[model samples]
Target: MPNTSRRTSKRDLTLVAVLVVAAIGLITYLVVSPPGGDDGAAQQPAGPSGPSASQSEGSAGADESPLSGLARRDEGDPTALGPVDAPVTMVMYSDYRCPFCAKFSRDIEPELIDRYVDSGQLRIEWRDFPIFGEQSEMAARAGRAAAEQGRFWEYNRAIYEDSPERGHPDLTREVLLDYAHEVGMPDMETFTADLDDPSLDEPVREDLRQGSSIGVSSTPTFVINGEPILGAQPLDTFVEVIEGAAGQQ
Candidate 1:
């Protein structure tokens, strides 16, 4: 008879290789599609979904990660928080009308600011990915307008804190103007003018394009360092990921 033992060993090795490929595929699916599934929010076509091999490793070097380049790290960016050179940078792709985004903003963001941002370990950058509808875009433009007047964060807080516990809010133009006033925007005249300014729309569109190109189909998606964290995950989850990324740096 043939060498039966050698044949079995070869078969085992082949099975192992297949299993490895399948595992990678599953992880890619999880990272791209996320848990809640598509809610028909994506207005643009999604690109390929899957992080590079380095993204799965907590200790992976930033230079080796394709996603790390996403962090703008612009110190002068009005919508961003924390230092430009913070050890860990999180690029948050969020929509104004997303309830889950509001939840994170109201509940977890303050803690993050106190624990990590204040300590100079983390930088959070905001990208206005308005996927909900027309009002969503309007709200996004309003945020940019608020940013111009140095009240972006305050406006952000007003919107999120006042949002309903579930579903999208009615972010009408009048409502947005009211929020601008409520946030104590220094120049309501300029803020109002900026809201109707067509140029302000480009930044919002660019943010949405950037997010869509990276397979972000939903709001509140985050790219922490090089790793993608989908949905409004628990605060502990953020801590773990942020700490892990900090450790790598």
Candidate 2:
């Protein structure tokens, strides 16, 4: 009977090992070759690593993986949603000009906020990983300007919700200001002045460098509790990953 029990335990251990290996392999494949090809999100060539976002922020432990350290749970972060200490932290790297990003913002983000963020189970930190062009950088700066007025998320929703469904909308300076006005930004003067502020450029640059260092080659890339979910996947995929991360905690 003891021999039988030992054999059963060994079999269980072997099964668990195989499952872990398979999961790792799948994640690696997804990272190396993102799904949905070109129509999914704005892509960029992976560049050499710069100063890691975690190292500069001093938010990660020596033992923690770079992916896990991506979450900046700064309570004062105006662009962030949910409690700083939530069990699951999802660090999102996105470009404002990406159509796929607009889709995620329009469809999936609201539901995520309602289900996980409102319930205090998840924290989402936004990173501006603009890869489109000059307009993309401008939009990212505009987002920072909105954050100064405590209306970052409002501005975010306005930009994405108003975006065209088929392709990237031309995010001109006038258009960005229009969105700001649409979101009822109280001091348009201050918002306008803040848009081209050189200081705002650093944060955007930092986020871009951070994303590049982490092998984020596309917009709408998400790092949920150390696991990467590239592109705007289905709602069920997000739910499953979020739940799995929550259960592990």
Candidate 3:
């Protein structure tokens, strides 16, 4: 058999770059396009149905690219916080077993939440893009189950705190249940039931599909207002991108 894994890895890196270039094109188009459907707006191509024509039209040639498709805003997602119409939407793709992802959870994300999410300038939507095999998938399901009880973020913090900084921990059902308990999930019965529900698998899988569509091979890749910031990038990078995105609003 051929080395499909290696080939896919190579493809992911190239696709990630597309996000950066696409962002530049998107930003420029936003600057050039007239905002309130003025006469110039008539010239812009009608974008794909998923994202608004205003945002996706800039990504014209890359019609099928994930960046345009992935920014759904998902207004009523139970696991998401902040206003759906917040000026900037940050879509985060993370693997529960990835250390850098844990670092982002522990380190940068809290600051972002306080500085932006609290101010109603940013809305963050989480996507579980587990790439570390079964254990990672299990953890993602556990998170989704926790969201049923309004404890997704709590469960996330507790599990990442307990997890090692590097390496995929064995996230068996027992461990997942323990983390649920640790996060003060009110009813273990409901939590466990949700965890095991086969129906929950599809949402987690859909998250993975969306992440892959956008070329996310690594953990903690963030698309802030359609601009990609990969890995556990420095706080300043986030600040600059977010401020710039916010400025456009």
Task: Give the total clashing residue pairs for model 1.
Answer: 0
How do the candidates rank by TM-score, highest first? 1, 2, 3
User: Candidate 1 on 1-249: residue-level lDDT in tens?
Assistant: 368777867755653454355345434644564322342222222333222234334323333444555666655889889998899989898889988799999999999999999999999999998878999999999999999989999999999999976667999999999999898999999999998999999778778777765666666788897677776789999999999999987
Tens-place lDDT per residue, model 2, 43-82, is: 2212322224443344234444446655656667898999
Give the TM-score of each candidate. Answer: 0.77, 0.76, 0.75
- The 10-residue segment of model 2 with minimum total lDDT is 39-48
The per-model lDDT (C-alpha) reads: 0.78, 0.78, 0.73
Model 2 CA deviation exceeding 4 Å by range = 1-65
Cα lDDT, model 1, residue 119: 95
* Model 3 whole-model lDDT (C-alpha atoms): 0.73
Task: Find the 10 residues in a row with the least total lDDT in model 1.
Answer: 42-51
Off by over 4 Å in 3: 1-69
Candidate 3, residues 1-249: lDDT per residue as tens digits?
369767766765654564465455544544554333342322222233135665546544432223433565555677676887888888888888877788888889899999999999988888888878888988888898888888899998887777766555678889999898887899899988887788888788777666554456667778886677877788999999999989976
- Where does candidate 2 clash, by residue pair? none
User: Considering lDDT, which of the candidate structures 1 and 3 is the better prediction for this target?
Assistant: 1
